[model samples]
Target: MASDTNELFPIPAYCKTIVGSEDGTIEDSPLQKLEISNPARILQLCEGLTDRTTKKLEIKINKYLQAETDASSVFMINLLTVSEEAMVQVVGDNILETSIRTPLSEDTISDIVEYKDNSLKCAEKLDPKLQTLINEIVTKDTGDLNIVPIVAKERRANIPKKTIVSPVYLVCFVNSSKDNRYITTLVHETFKYCLALLLNTRECEEERRLKQQCQSLLAVARKLFSHLGDLNDLLKEIMSEARRLTNAERCSLFLLDPDHMHLVAKVFDGMSPAEKNTEVRIAKDQGIAGHVAATGTILNIKNAYKHPLFYKGIDEATGFKTRNILCFPIRDEDTIVGVAQLCNKMDGHFDYFDEQVANAFSIYCGISIMHSLVYKRIQDAQARSQLSNELMMYHMQVSDQDVADVVTCPNSHDLPNFESFSFVPRRVFHRETPCFVLEMFERLDLIDHFRIKRDTLARFILYARKGYRDVPYHNWQHAFSVAHFAFLCLRNFQLVEKGYLSKLEALAYLISCLCHDIDHRGTTNAFQQQSNSVLASLYSSEGSVMERHHLSQTICTLNTEGCNFLESLSREDYIKCLDLIKNMILATDLAIHYKLHSRQLAMAQEGFTRSNPEHRYYLCSLLMTCADLSDQTKDWPETKKVAQLIYTEFFMQGDLERKMGKQPVDMMNREKASIPDHQLEFLTECCICIFRILSTIFPSAKTLVDSITRNIIAWESSKNVFDKLRVEGCTSYDVLISEELERQVQATLECMQDP
Candidate 1:
């Protein structure tokens, strides 16, 4: 049975029978029908009917010359169609002697104006001698086939060697009649052999062309099979071959992104590095490739701009001008797998020969894609396993023995001000933070209420803390701070007791906060994508790459030995717990928060219902975001300090992006970023809407909102101060902000002491 949700559509059981082969056709192995051991052949389409009417004409023309004019008196043996510039004589020798020919009229000249227009323009520039000859033929009304040689000789008096007339009528004329014949002096049998030679030469040329195509196909097949790995590399090879086969200036390959059910351009030839790295997705019914994939027909475009479906966005973005295009579908058996597009043929528009090669080339692409996809699955599984084991060995070497001492909950007396929204973990003894985290669980009665084993809970914290990289802002300290804020809300907001949140919800919320920044690399999601990090490659399609990795790390820690904190819960509760954890963790991604802001606000305005799942999700999402940005609600000094840490990380990423020749966003660019103004924008635009929404829901949470509102003022003041500094020759601002932030922290602390 096909799994509708499976990315590979019909390959639902692929991973089940992945080892070696099952019936020699395991989905994770090379396709048996593909015959990796054999070369593929392009199926020959039906041969077209040749124009053998010319052969029969060769016979009749010979008879007419041997006999007199009007030889077949029952019918007109010769007919002439005259234009203003040229006279064309044609006769259908296919008709029997009794058949009558239609006589040419004066109106016939205007009927063929399209064929004569260019010829008429050129004839106007002809020399006097050719003009006289053309006039004589028209005056005498004797534009016969024999007079063509005289007309051509007169026409070429201007440029004799450069002009040679093609003879559709006289190329094989063998005039044995000596009375009035002047066109040819050849004997009867000689013409037959010349025609035979012409036929043989055309056949040989066609044979050689097909043989070349076969050789090219054979070589490309071997290359696709022998290539080592990497889907991008295989696609580039496909693009190169497509371009070579089509003689095109550029080529691109669009494949079905099984996940999105859309065509994504995986690789492009003749593109810049950044453009190549960028992924472009279009519907299977949207663009040129879309047309081909949707209809299963080739579109050979002469002028791309004039085509209805052609859009200039891609050309403008990539700095490539598209004059022409030839797009065709790639198929595997009955399934149309993808599309190959060729642009700008070197000589002219893609003709029949190029289309045939491209059609055959698409077969190679489809088979290679199948092989590459299967190989990638096998390699990804092995790499993830090896990387996980290696990452565990390298990053998470701590064990039960190491965390056993810290696993014991601290006495509650030693942990004061724990439920305050204004609590700053930076002031606490660094070594006692883990115990305080445990006591958070203890206070929530999570340790007792949910039957969370104390030692396992402690180990989970240590693993999560270890999971965070030592970055400036999103390190262990930041994760702990975020977790502390969530604990305060759970303890002070009385959400769980008031039925606004369940114990499981609170547990998921706290755990989500604790692990949300795990394994962070001090970079934004955009940075991860720009740099093409492993995390981005893994989760970028689903989006929120860093946040998703944090969640993955949380799961990895929970499953680690002695750290299955959620294992005590029932299966249903465990699944729900992880689901909430995933949602809450992803909610910390500000991008998601910005998207959900309007929904959160509307729900808050509409009133929260504990029974409404949407209400619960929006409320929980709101709480998670508020907790993540809790540092912003701290007192002035801590707010400035945290701002320094964040901007420091942002600027560092900006420097790295600059080194890679990519322009960072305004807020990330250290030199251009006005710290105070950016923060004010963030606070006013992106942050305040959600915080205000939170305030509307829980009136007591207004204290959290109040703190942010005050800090917004200080940022407004700092903007003025920074502007003055820049006027006085401050070139780089984040550094100036860093220096001024430390000074302001001390000054604010002193003022508070004096008060």
Candidate 2:
């Protein structure tokens, strides 16, 4: 049976001579020599061969030289050597040897490579002889053997066509004895390995492609943020970049509503604006995008329809069918703000590659959006600063002159006793009146109303020096301007006898203006109320933020300092002062703005006509109101500054209202046209109102009013110019209060020194 099989397995050309070496000997039967050019050729030959011949070839090659033979037989042994199987053993052994490894050093390399394949690990046992052999083999550059394994598989593939050639290929490295099972596998096992290799190669290519796409997406996202002007531009750029990188049919971005629990589709592509109008809503954990957002993780869906949570409503509405989705959450550091999703990938269904790309995209989007928000905040803060500076110059200009002059008063006697007033308490007797009033005025800086007759003369200098650090609009400067205006109005009222001053009314106007906005935080009353801040809680949210706390702080500071101003007052006068202060401070609230303006207008229409106490009292109240908004009569820079502060307060209130889930009033609505227009309209009204009031009260104010009117008109002309043109809009930080404004606002200490 063996002889018949040998005849049936025709001897290959290279094997014929080796079989002829010995006569009539079983070993003389040509030890099948399978010679191939390379490892790849081995795969081809294995495909054509049968199962049984491959085994016989392995046995014949092994017996060619059972022990060291003559040099004459060297060619026979080399030709018959089917060592392709050894390459597999080498690879397998290498995997194991390196698997249980230490660092690769010169000493370790030799032992690791040349060690015998006895199936024993380094931990089990050590053969000194085998270890020594391994050292020498690794150290020496044994030529040909290093290149020997490349041909091993080839030789196995080249067996004679007559023999039942198996698919298995034997591979061996000539130099090392580390791997002994050269060609051990049958054809079936080889096929399995090839399949696995194909799968692994495909995965590697996919991983590389995914990484490249991710890198590209990130680059585009960063560029978009640096130039984004508003939320609309931001969303558009995001959508464009996402589609570009993913090569998808469509891409969408959804932001978490301010409540932060639901996703609202803010931007999308391949959809009409009308359809996109109603933002898509989903729970944080709802769909693939929502799931990613809720968990702040990457989500990969191979089939959208297969997903239980893939809301089909989106498909029906957009008339777009989605098969696969790659979604990732956009996070601002640790907080998930929104999610991004890509649909209908251009290539094969979205997989791990798409997931990786989406993740990278999300990172860039998150970082850029955060930077834009911060930039916007900085711009707002800068605008507020400039506004404060303008107010400062206006305040200083008015404070330096005589308040009686600016308001156009005819009398010189009742003008505040500027020459006799002393800020310091020189004697115990002086502390009760002059000393006390001076001290409050110094802290508040209310001396500005007396100086500037020109409508261009601004007030509110304290705000410029202090800026928006501790307080918002209500600061030392605002308090001072209010007091000065109040005092002048008080004197004018008494002169006209529109109302009576018993000592109480005089002191009350002074006190109220000084303390109205003390300890302000440059934010808003609503902020205090919404935050339920300690100030709000302590005052019981009973009135506006500053107005509510003004009285309490004034009383506390007065009591703590133990000023004697009230000691001389009769009970009636003291009560009257308290009442006046409370009423004036409460009037600062915008909620009562219309009423206050109407009453002031009514008094102005009454004319500087009557010389009675009742008429004088009405004039006093009217003048106080004028002083509150006197910024309009200030110089260009100062007036603009005051206006800016008021605007900031308004915008900040809008922001707070939005955050608290309340609808914004007027320009505060979450729409584009509402903000700047609202600001301009209100400011224009104020300019007209202030101009009219000043014209009525101070006849000399005509030139000042004309100048102010020109500036106001100039602002209207540009639509971009600030009431004061430092750089134009508060947004332009390049321009600031002119050097002249700065110098004018820095009042001479000499004037304040006496009172």
Candidate 3:
């Protein structure tokens, strides 16, 4: 299957051999009796009217067309929309080459002056011989270019009575072609590619212009920044650049004086140099500038003298009449800082297009006005970069021998439960877990398929192991378990084979599962509020603090020297993979998972399409969460041990919270917490509910549901033990309940054996 639709574009098809019929006997006719026709005209589509811009395009199409037909040009060229997609006709005697008349006739001038609104009508209005060209072009797919051969009786002028069956071949410039097609296919197919190139060229030119404008804006910003220490120089520079960009005869930069409720500017463009330093003030509601400053609105007035908001006192004092004005409020976010007013536009009046240019310029003006703090922010950003580099020193590189230690693929038979969803990852030694990860990569051929260098892949695996802090349930052991679950789901369910996931998505899934809890503090999101670290400060306000930290740690590893496994991917694919990893890891947060999972489940019940990106995202999130909580799907003994470990960390946090005069939640408070109740509630609401959803989407996951149900039974039995012991005056019964559960499993298996 194709990786993407773009990869499928240029595969050519020569359908004539398969779809064409064999009806007539082939014959070789004399060269003089044959004539080949090529309708190689072009119609450019944009906003302008210069058709000659396509003259070179027309010649190229004609050349390719002749190669297709083995013939000469037959039809005339008529194209439009070449000038930014426009139709501009070159008039005078040159246009009448259709007849080559000597002096210009009145009818010819009238024809030159006449205009048609659209392309179809214009094609019909062209020379009458090829009037059907446009209609023919619209009827066929432009890419399915085909040539047709026609036979007709031709007689020379010397012997006008004799009839001869000569052929005229109509050739189109497709990479391949079909027969018995109309001339319209030839017309559109030739013009389609040529005009498309012109359109691309036009887009490039537009991009160049935008880059030039950006460079100019940057230059203006630099000049203004240099003058920040001197308000006089800064104000003068701001007014000069603003006036030049908007094409105004005079301009003023007015600062909002909040204390006195007036607009002030130290420099005015229309005043003499001697008066330039004098401050000008107007009431907050007096003139156009004042209105803009007060209300924070941009206004372009065509006739300034007639507007009701116009204040004529300044014009009367300066003895200069203001014919037009464009006034805009300069802002720092929502707060109005100043107003830029332009008077008497040099070209007609100011327009909306001018407003856009001035608005961009206003950003620098606002920066100049607010320079007291922005310069410090720029310096702080640079310092942040240096600090980020220093932090990277902790993400150490794995030695070559460390990579070689795990690089050898392990035997599948020796690695029991390696591919099983019910596998207990904590049983495997922490150092050996990286070997299993490497084996899984080799099992899926991820290293070879994604162009990941062998050493880079191994170093990344080692880096991931080290990135995790040693915690009760959120460390390297938990990370490897989650990743192993993802690996099984991918391999067993035929997710890639059935098109539910792409290779990039599967790669991201495994990576996210392995690194989702990196550097986790073994507590809740409380660290984000209580700690003052850089990671918390960067991601705290965004919410999903712990999940975001996991993603950041994953990125930091990839950005390290030898652990950069994703460097071989193209820019687009690399970005898409990173985005997928971020979203999937973040979705491991239960709140985010529920929001998208429910909506996606509703849609899936209706009908699911893996092709839809939103559906795929939801599916990936569900898988990530399932992988995260995968221990609930293991055997009863493992599940019991996992619960004890989770509560072990919880009780530790509760003890610390109590010491700090804080009330810990019941689940974490060892004295108040009932293990059976909390265990049952979590199983019923989170574990069982999630596994049921997974089974609904992928039936192979039904085994996970069975394991959860068995665990729920164990929790219920524990509840019974707790209630009985409490009545008998014993408070601790959790371990006794686990032993009883083991007894029940053994008895049930023996009874099945007897049957």
Candidate 4:
């Protein structure tokens, strides 16, 4: 039987059996031969036919009857009238009497009663279980209501008395209570049943709709993933999709505060031109939307004003009305990732349908929010990396060698123009190790230069004499490497080349490296004034503290050497290498970034001017800077050491500044070590700078540069992660690397020095 209700319509299923024919085939219908079926006779047939069996009879009656009634209602007439009239013709006049007057036997009645009694007993036993099963099936669907079957009992005169009675279910109205108004009960049950059927259909449709939405979302996700590079675009896509799915007239997404208790709106749709900068903030527990957000649940309000939790103050301030709201908390697992609100549903009211739609969307919202957040982070990180690299390249460009390519010496260019300059015969400087030059300076008379050698340069030399134990390649090693590498360039130019070796040239390169750190201090340019370092006053901020130190150190190394490299060189060669080394060492300060960039551009314009002594000096200066940053291109173990050394130098400087009540320099002033990932990121940029510069000046070194770059990437792969709370973790620079370990390292060096 088809159930009918206001909100839902049920379509009838075909009945399995015919009403009267024993064969249950329409060809055997008695009504086929019926001549005049009077209205009264039709009414009788209608009453005789089971109300539950209509679709089949309709088909049968439509075949045999020519009635004024609609084809569907034509089957409502009495079946007996059709049967009797047709039977009378076949069996003579006796059929009428037999059909009308035949009495049912008591035994037959008794058997019917017995069967009914047994059926009722079993049905009664199954009803509760059946209801339970129905409830289970509908529990997940919010629209489902409890539906109970209608059961009736029948008794016959010949039936034997029994404990159980036969019960028949009419499958009529779902009754809320025994006293439910009969008409309303019928309506409610029929309506409820119809709704259940409709719901099944609706669910199928809804699933299809949701599946399509998911496909769309997945497509958007795939597109955004491809733009892994453009995070801003990715975030924009996510916000746009959120608005589209909610059918919201306007929507906005907020970033959670670091504390996670409040939300700060970051992006929006449907904002007035004037409201672009407007901030919307709500507490975790504030309104219908906020409650859903706070509890990580869905909140649907058909009428926002009627809800106790709805606050109108925000609407008043923002000039946006809240009519209907569908909100769901965006969650990544048990953690609430964010809260999303779809306000003023385009349909004007939030319903069960809205809930289903929103619930489906919430899943995408949560994932999209997570994905977008990650995308933005990666974008920010990459931008920072690019900027750092650009700066490093800029520095490489301005090295001393770079300057020589553009600007000739004040008077040296006029000294001599030979077919080929008589290049100096070279002597190897610091044969055992580059640090030997510092020891050689131990015998210099620094008093002539108005300096106390023992207090300054000699102290530095003494420190280096403590011995080299493979300290990681950090700033200190970078400085030492630069010194050694400068020597290599000088030796290569002077000794390796045919007729290239020159005494003057060798002195120029060796002395340049030796005096590179004469007045060295363990701080950056910014800290010089704050710590009242002597170099700060001496240089008067004309140049970086480190650069000033390098020049001073070179001048002092001169007072000690038996033959000054400066005196040995021709005036032209002397000025060229001197200018070259000065600019190269200065590039290490990182403060002269603009200067470095300008010089590199000049070098580029000059093309391959390596054969020019001045140009060779320019290139040599650049090579030294490269060596200083070489750790960035080193193997993991070597790079790790450099990171440690750089960190230590930064911390030592930061400590001094902090003690003096100044801001700590860069990342070092913090009270913890920096995360390895960030450190590795820093190294990666450094590598790019080295590789880029080498590609330009010393293309032969590309293989070596590439190896270092590979190691940095590998180190990043095995990075160490630290909790924000763990103070000792390597996410900051101030974290101490155990005093005992430092002492042991120093002790090891002392033993080596004694032997």
Question: Candidates ranked by TM-score, best first?
Answer: 1, 3, 2, 4
* Model 3 agreement with the true structure over 1-755: per-residue lDDT tens digits: 54454333322232122211253322233321211222212222222323444334334445545545433332222321111111111111122222111122224222422321122223334443222432333244434333332223345576678964432212223323323232333433444335455444545655775687788889999898998765667888888888877778988888888888889887888798888757778888877888888777788887888899887887898899999898998887658888998888786667554677788888888877789345545654664565457545655657888988777645443466667786677888777888788877878778889888888888898988888776787878889889999999999887787889998899999999999998787878774466445555556546787888788778988987888999999999999999999999999998787777677667557665877877888789889989999999997778877887888778777787787788889888877778878888998988888888788888789999988887777667666566666667653325433466457654554454594
State every prediction's TM-score relative to the real structure.
0.59, 0.34, 0.51, 0.33
Residue 317 lDDT in candidate 3: 88
Off by over 4 Å in 4: 1-480, 487-507, 561-580, 598-606, 611-618, 670-678, 722-755
Task: Write one digit per residue (lDDT tens) for candidate 2, span 283-394.
Answer: 8777787778777777767678988878888789667889878777888897888888888877645644455566777778887777766776676456445544543454
lDDT of 1 by residue, 605-662 (tens): 9999999999999899999988888888888888887888888888899899999999
- Measured by TM-score, the strongest candidate is 1
Candidate 1 clashes: the total is: 0
Higher TM-score: candidate 1 or 4? 1
Error of 2 at 186 (Å): 8.7
lDDT against the true structure, per candidate, is: 0.69, 0.49, 0.67, 0.45
Estimate the TM-score for candidate 1. 0.59
Please name the candidate that would achieve the greatest lDDT relative to the true structure. 1
RMSD of 3: 28.3
lDDT of 4 by residue, 1-755 (tens): 23443213332233122243342212323333322223333443344444233233333333323122212111111111111110010111111122111112323222333222122332244334233433432343333122222222333455556332321221211112221122213222232223233334434655676788778767766765665544345545656665676666766565555475776664556666566555667676776556766676787666778889977886897788888777776666557766666678664445444566566655665565666667666754564456335434532222333223222323322112111112111112222332233322322222232232323333333333222223232223444454545444444333324333234444444445544544355556667766655556445435676576666545444433332424534578667766655765665655553345446546745664646665555454555555555445444444545556667767777677777777763577556445455566665655466456656654555655665655555444433213322435443432223333334434543454594
